[model samples]
Structure formats: structure tokens, C-alpha cells
Target: MASETDAPVDGVLIGEEATPIDLTEQAEVADASFAQVSQVQTVINHIHGDIGGASFGISGSRTKSRRTSGPVSGHEMAEARTRYERHESYEAAAQQLGRCNMVALIGTAGTGRRTAALNLLHDFVGGRREVVVELSPAYTLEKLATREYRKAHGYLLCDWPKDDVDGSIADFHLREIRRRVRDAGAYLVITATATSLPAGDQILWQPPPARDVLLAYQVAPEIAAEAAAHITPEHAMADVVALARDLAAGAPLDQALGRLESAGRRDVVAWFDAPRSRGELFEMAAMAFTAGLPEASFESLLARLESIAGIGMEKADAVSADDPMPSRRLLRVAEGSLFSLSPGRRLEFKVASHRTHVMRELYQRHGMRLWEPVIEWLHECAALRDNPSAQAEVARGVAILASVSDYSYVDSTFLTPWARGNGVMRSQATAAMAVSWLCLDETTRSEVLRTVSSWTRASAARPKFTATLAWSGELGIRFPLEAVRMLWLQIRNSEKPVRHAEIALARLFAALTEATGNALPMLDWVARQISNDKRIGRAIDPLIRAILSVLSARADGVGIPTVTAHLRTRPDSAVPLAKLWSAVLVKRPHRRDALAALYDAVCAFDERDDDDRDHVRALFAALVEALPAKERPLLAHDLRRYAISRNTDENRLEILLSLLRVFLSPAVLSLDTIGKHP
Candidate 1:
């Protein structure tokens, strides 16, 4: 995030007395400065385009009239040349274009492949009297054999061999077209969306990097450094040409996204309206995640949405152009691509929220079965953790997919642990597993509950799973009553208290209250678990506090009997019982039995395990402070008698003195204050 311009620049100055400057040193200095600027400037320029550069011309500069296809006018031609030179790859592609006779250029839309092809053709023509004609995707072999097609010395075919067009049929057409052109001593250049073209040298078009975006827009160094502080180089450079053009037309950075989103939406909607197979159309829905389809097998799938919606094969070029096919127009409403090209041209989605929105709709329509292939692809990428960028992308997708509420076809083996079983997906996969848990039939749900009753193995995975269930329950999504009951039972049955168990219980308490619209079930469940779970000595205080907090907030019921019965049953429940009294006494503070329970729990201590005895002794000392001023006298007498009973044991006697001092001198009851006790 540091300013690029603020960094010290390396220098190698040449004086007039010097014979010849070392070119190597000068090159090093220039490379260092370029590297510094490239990282910072590209990010800033992407969000805020350079206003002084060329206006919106990537798509806008192209001739609008579909029927009129050829080289653009003089001014537009100049703009394409300037944008192409902003990167070395564009220059290389342009140079390569002139060398090949039958050249097939393959690339996704908006990658500047067509523009590079046109530039090469312009240079190839030079000042000679050479004829040039561009055939549309709709062109046929029969049309190419005509005098006008055969007589032309050069040719350009745009978006040829549509998705449904057979490979053999398209290849036969290409072979004959090239033969006729070679026989006539003419040249041909075809720019098609097909994955692999037949009989021609092919070039894959790579889009300019983010840094080149700043170069194409003529962004100033100082201003770019200031803007670059907040963005990173990995940010998507989609439609950079359009961005530069928009900025050149005087739009500000703040207003550009809104305008861009509106325009992008219109283009995406049009692409969905074209005719194609149901299977191919389904792939378009998946395109929201994959970013861009690769060219190696573009014919096997749909290309850019624009390529299909905007271009169609000539009736002759398409084998089934007239045959009736199933309609795929139901998905016309789903629009926009969250994924964009990285510097390596690999697909990545920058925003998590956009991914959630797209996946939500896709699931709502076709369900999780539709996501099997996408999930498999994500799993494959996730295993490459050595690449931190890829790991982060996979993590984001995992988070979005985890939020899926529907459980149809979701199972245990769905998200297998990868990276040598390190359990990287454990946390993210917990939510999805919660959904699967909710889907079980009553008998199976109960049997599954009995399986996890122990608190030993997979302890980490259990708490997260329990928390996720409580989380979903609070959202008003229905889980079986038996499932909730068994969860509460498992918490009660736990031999060793789980970390974050209190938080998990609170969420479950909230979920139960929301699910039934009543507080009695939650209160009853909490009261029963306190008495039934004998291992509650450690987790009791937190569990009671969680119960009290929820009960006070809702204040929906007055079931003191159920609470008192559970507390009274546990003779050693002073710590938790005292907390229960503290909450209940807010309404009825004069409850004598609640005070009696505290006194008995204090006097009944047997001092067997030193840790348990010390913990209980501290609980009783704390409870003395919570009692009313008048009630303290009775607690004082009980503490004094208990001190005499433990006089023979040094540790118990010391603990007793600490408790008595708490009642006799309330301000000095703290552990630090007790340390200075006689």
C-alpha cells in the first residue's frame, strides 16, 4: 500500500567527460522503476481510469452495423494501434499475424484478438492494390467458391463454426476454402471462437495485464501512485479498453461502476437469448463460476455469452441450423460474470458476495446436483495450496457453497479431505454437513446422535458441527425436534467440557426458542440437562449463565418450579444454583430456598479432589457477595461452622479462612486481597 513515487529511485548519471555510458546499468535502473510503477499504477488505474487517454473504443469503436464489416475508419484505426502497443504480447501477436498464410486466431471476446488481427492485415496490405474481404460467421463454403471470394487476395472470417456446428463439416469447408485461395494465389485469415481450428497455424490471444491498462490510458505517475495504495495487482482487468474509453469521455471513478454494470447487464441478457442445446445452455449457468471458458475445447461448450447471443452460423455452415432443437431460453435472466482473467489468464472471482448471489440462484433453480462438476473443479484447485492466491480463491468459493440450505443429494463423501488429510476443509465443510444432518429421517438421526455421544475423537470437528446446527436453527430453517433434543442430550452427556460449548448452547437455546415461538422447551431443556449431566461441575457456571441471559431477554414464561426442581435435586449445585437464584431473584429476591441451596452447597463440601474442592470453595465465597445485606449474616455463620469442621486439614482450613474473610470484610474478597490474609 505504500506510494510508488515516494520510493527512492536508483540513478546512473552520464557526465559529458565520460567516454561511453554502460548500457547495462541504465537498463537496470529503468527496469526497477518500471517494476515499482507497474504494481502500484495498474491497481489504481483500474478503479480510476486515466481521463486524458482515448475514449471507450474496445466494443464501441467497432462498426455498429453488423452488415457492414471491414477495417474501421482512420481515427479508430489509430486508437487500436495505440492500445496494442501498451503491452509486448499484443505487439508479438500483431507481428505473428503477418507471417501465417491460413491463420486462425482463437480467444474469448473482449481480449483484443480481433483488433490485433485487423492491425496485421492493415500492415500486410501496405500500399499495394490488394483486395480484402471479411466473411461473417454466417458465411458458407458455396459463397466462398463464388468469383468475389475466390478473386480476393485476402480474407477475414469472424466468429466462425458456431457451437452446434460439427467439427468435420467445418474442417471440410476450411480445407476447400484454403485450396481455392491457394489456387488463386490469395491469402486467408479466420478469427473463430472454436477451441481448436483445422489446417491453419493458430495463435491464442492474451489480454493485456493490469499494469498495461495504466499505460494504455496514459495515467500520470504521481497521481497513479496515490490511487494505487488501496488496490492490488491481482484485481481483474476485464474490459480495460472500455474503461479507458469511458474515462476519456469524462466520467469519474465513483460513477463508472454503476454505468458499467448497466451496460454489461444488457450485453449479457442478449447473449442468453440465442438458440442452443439444453446441455450447452446449462454450461452458461456454470460460466458464472469458471470465469472464462478455455479455447482448447470451446467447440464442445459455449464460448462467451456474447459470441453465442450475437453471432450465428450461416444456414449452410450449420448442419442443423433449421432442425428443431429443444429450447434453452429459460435461463435468459441470469446475467453477469463475477470471475475475470488473472495476469496468467486463469479465472478468479474477486468478490465473495457476487459468488454467493450467483450460486444462490443457480441452486434455487437446479439444486446441488448441478454443482457436482463445479465442486469437483474447486476440489482440484484447492489441492494446490502451494499457490497462496489459488488457496484463497478456493477458500472463498468453499464459504459460499457452505451456506446452501437445501440438502437434496448432499452427503458425507461430498467434501473429501484433501492436502494429505490435514482437514483444511473441516471448518468450511461443517455448515454443509449440518444441512446433511438435518435431512436425516427420524430413526437415522437418532442412531447418528448415539455415535457422537463420546467427547474423545474428532473433538474439534464436533463443536463446529454443533455450532453450525445452532446457527442454522436460529435462521428459522426447520430442523427435526428429535435432532434438537439429541443435541441437548449430547451436551449433557459430555464427560469433558468442550471449548466454546457455552456459545454453542446459547445458539441452540436461541434456535429452539425461534423454532417453536415458545420459551418453555428451551428452559425445560436447560433445567433437565443441569441435573442429568453429572459431569456438569466444570461447565455448570457458563451453562447456567447462558440459560439466565436468554430467559431474561425473552421473559416469555414463569416456570420457576422446573428450574428449582432441577437445582434442588443436585445437592452440590451451589455455583450454578447460586447463578440461577441471581437471575430468578430479580423478580422475587425473597426466595428462602434459593438462599438455603447456596448455604448447603457450601457446608456439604467433602474436600476430596484438591482442584474440585478449591473451585467449589471459591464459588461459595463469590455467592456470599451476591446475597442481600441481611442474608449475609446467615452465610457468615455457615462459613464459620464449616471452617471449624475442616480445622484438621491445612488446605481446607486455609480455604475456609478465605471464605470467612470475604463475608467479614467485603471489599477485600478478591484473590489478590486474600493472598495477604492471616
Candidate 2:
């Protein structure tokens, strides 16, 4: 394996800016059969977080009070004050509130009705902070009508229920609410769907163009304009805001928009649910699964689908009767040139978002009647050794299916069968990739983690190995601490530690250190593990090897080792680094590797004109202090012998010997001897 420094940092992981490990390369190194699963690597590279850039959910410094019932928190209000974009109806609504002391803002869902209401109340109260109290959505017209209000304060009621027993919205109720607000010298804004209320008191609201909302969030104008091109009247303000936030965070426009459209629209469901020929439905399924593959691959998969679904005869009969051209039939469901002269022509849906929707509806609503055949087809595709790309695309489709369908059902039907036993490496790779995908969505992430964690304890090596591969890829990148902890569990529980588990631990640490440019957290974790056990037990050999691997790994075209660079960036990490190094030196098997890595770091620091030398000296001092007095002389002798073998200049060798001497002085030795006696 290439050193960490020589490893090229690939694309970013979803919701995180981390270097993704090339699992295919790593897998091949362990088992040559894994070379055929290269498509797994490609799938990992293309996976992005869902819209909103939150793998878990949108997180910020804003307080939790934003979601609670009370006066809106000052922090939340300040945020809204900057990002709120007023609709055309906002001014008219504002004027009504100013004159009547209350106004009802009505609009279709996702039109920013609630936002307009909040803004109106904020302006009506003259922008006084925390004066805007958000009333519960459960408040009925009767309660609101008789409710007393605070003078000079603003009240906002969002999405007030229409089915309240107080009866449908009436003119008398509006008049009473208005009277109450005016008498109290307060303002109230009620946001609701279009209702049979008096027009004089209600303003039908329409949100501004999606671009304006994006701009309000400080999104780049070009990106916002491009995103706005795809926005339709049906796209909700909330989804658009999420899109803007994602675009601002440097997410690709197409991927973000695809997730937005897939989540926001149900057109795909309607299309699938509508009456359609069995042949056509099968064609759609084939297209959904093999959309990006070449035309020949599509035809092969489609034929397999038709055959499995018992629609081949039906498809032939329909073609004989209607004689519709293949392109025309394909045009009905998908959008690609079937007759393109190019040999590499690919077939895909007109709307890329529909592919996921198609698979989701087919697997969920259609159930096993469709899923059994689809699973069989996916497995066949996974077994295609001649077309690794097709196999990869199959894995991608399976991941999407797993994400959309009932997870347990997918697990039973597909993941379990492919992941356990002597299943082909390609199939196991697909299962592992699917688990990684499940980890990307907030709804499924925890469940996926729990399931994979359980798999680590399975008696079968393949399942455990699959779980290890899942963590070594995107799962580890997104949740490094959890990934590390769970991997340790797998390692400690094994009767004999799996080599793959050891390699995965190393990759996880290397990728994390490369991405963060700081190894302190990982180094600190190693220190804690060592200190808690108070012995360099064989159980922690994997952890020790991982630390050494990181220390020796180098980036491409960079001379400094990963650890040296980390020390230069954060000199304080030397303390923890030394502690881990001390453990490595005493581990016997890793002693030589640890010393060699330390010598390289010392040499790199010696060449620099900065304070990095002090870090090296501190590291050496801590390393010596952490060792037993009986081991210090042995460590010194090892360093001298290792330096002589390397044939380095005397200055570098003298630097190491001198630090060892200072920390192992007669006074320190006597104190260590006394402590051991005590």
C-alpha cells in the first residue's frame, strides 16, 4: 500500500470534507477477486449527501428554542431577519395588519406563507427583538378570538388547523380576533391555507422567485440562477432554501437539484401508479436500473426483466399488434436516443430524479411481486464479470433500492443473501456499498450503523468482512469516532484478528489524518486506549500498527511524513504522539518500524528553520519518560543501531542519542528506579 502522504485525496465524502479511501484497491490487495469490483469504488466517488448538506440534519449554533413554543429566540430571529425574502403579497398583507392590527396570510403549502407572517409581525412591532411570540399550531379560532394579547407585542400563528371544532373560518370570528388585537394595542398574523374568510382581512400570499430566496441566503448569483432554472411553482420554499444552502456549501447543482426534485415531487409515483402495460412497466424497471449503461446493456437487462416478470410474450404480442418503434416506446418512459449512431450511446430518464422514484415505487408499492424479479436481475448483473461498469451500476441501483424500500425487507431479500456465505466478491461489495448509502440519509443512518455493528459480531467471516469494508469507505469518513469504536469491537471480539480489519483501521486513521491535517484526536484516542489498559496488550496491536502506518504514510510529492506535518501544524500533538510511539516501541514486533518513523520525522524537523525541532525534542522526551527505566537503555541501543543501518549523517543520529541521554540521565534513572521500588 502507498504511504498516506503519497495517496491522492479523492472526492469529498457526503456531508464531510474527508479523503475517501480507495476500497477497491485496498480490497484487491487483500483478495485478487476484488479487482472485478472496481465499480464499487466508482459508486463511492459519486455519492453525495442529500440536499441541505446534512447527513444527520442541518446543524448550527442556533439554539433549540427555535423549534419550541415561545417567543422566537433572538438568535433565530436574527438569522431570519437576514435570510427572509418577502413575497409580492407581503406589503399588502403588512398594510392590512397595520390598519386592522391583525391579518390572515393565505397561500398554498411551500409558498413561504409562514415566513411572510413572521416578517409582518416583526415589522409591525417595529422590529423589537423577542417580542414576536409564536402561538401553538393547535390554537383554535375560538380560543384565539377571546385571547388577550400583550400591548405593543407581536403574535404569529402558523398553519392553524382548519378542521378545528370551532367550525370553519367565519367573518364573525375574524372580526372578534381583530377587535381583541386592536383593543390590546397589539399585532397578530395568522398564516393558513386559502379559506372562506372575509377578503378584507385575508391576503393570498405567493412566494418570490426561488432565485431571490437563494440570493437572500447569500448564494452565488450564477449558481442561484442555474438552480432557479429548475425551480417550478410546485417546488416549496423550504426545499428551495435547502437547495440554496447546499449550493452555497459547494455541492454540485445537478446532484442537489436531483435530490430536491426527487423529494419534492410525486409525479413519478403517479406515472407508475397509472394504468400501464406490463411490458412497459418492465421496460421502465430495466431503464431505472440500467439507465446509464450502454444501449446493449440496457436491452440485455430489459430482456432479463421481461423474462423474469413473464412479460416477454406479452411484450412481443404488443409489438406485433401496434408495431411501435423501440424509440417511441422508450420515449414514453425514459429520455435517451436509442438510435444514436455512436456505439457508446447510453439510455437514461429525461428527468434524472425519476430513476430513484421509479425504483422506490416499484420496490415499495409494487412489493415482492416486482422486487423478487428485480433482485434476481440485480444479482445477475452483479455476476457479470465481463462488464464491471454494469456491475457497478447494479450496485448503485441496489443502494438506491435499499435506501427507498423497507430496509428490513431489502436486508432479508438482497443484502443478506449477497453478503453472507461464499457469495461472490462483487455481490458482497454491492451489499457493502448499499450499507454505505444507507448511512448517508439521516432517517436510515442510525439503523444502518446499528445493523452493520451487529454484522461485525456475526459468526461468518464474509459478513464481518463486508461490515469492515463498509466502515473503511464512506461510513468511516462521515463518522470517524463511531467507525473507530465499532471497528475496535470487531477486532477485539475476533478469535484471531482479521487482516482486513487491521488494514481498515489503518486506512481509517490515514484518511482522517489526511483530510483534517491534524492527528491529535486520533493520537489522543490511542493514548487513552493505552492508558486505560496500562499494557501494550496484543489486543491493541492493530491500533499500534495503524498509528505507525500514519506516521510513515506520505502524501504525493510531499517529503514530510504525515506525522511530521501534523506535528508542524499542531505542535501540542507531540505529547500524545510520543505516548503512542512509546507503546509502539515496547510492542516488540513494531519496535523497528516505530524507530525508523521517528528518525524520519527528526530528519524532516532538522531541515526546517522553524520551531518544529522543539516538537521533535518534546516528542523524544515524552517517549523516553513514558518508557520504563529498564527499557530506556534498550530503546537507546535500538535507535543507535537503526541509525547506523540507515547510514544517515551524524547530526541526525546525534540528535536522537542526545535527547535519549537527556531523558535517561542518572538523576532520572534513579527517580524511575525509586518509583518502581516504591
Per-model TM-score, in order, reads 0.28, 0.57
- In lDDT terms, how accurate is model 2? 0.64
Tens digits of per-residue lDDT for model 1, 132-177: 5555333455455453444434566655543344777756665676
lDDT of each model, Cα atoms only? Answer: 0.41, 0.64
The local distance difference test score of model 1 is 0.41
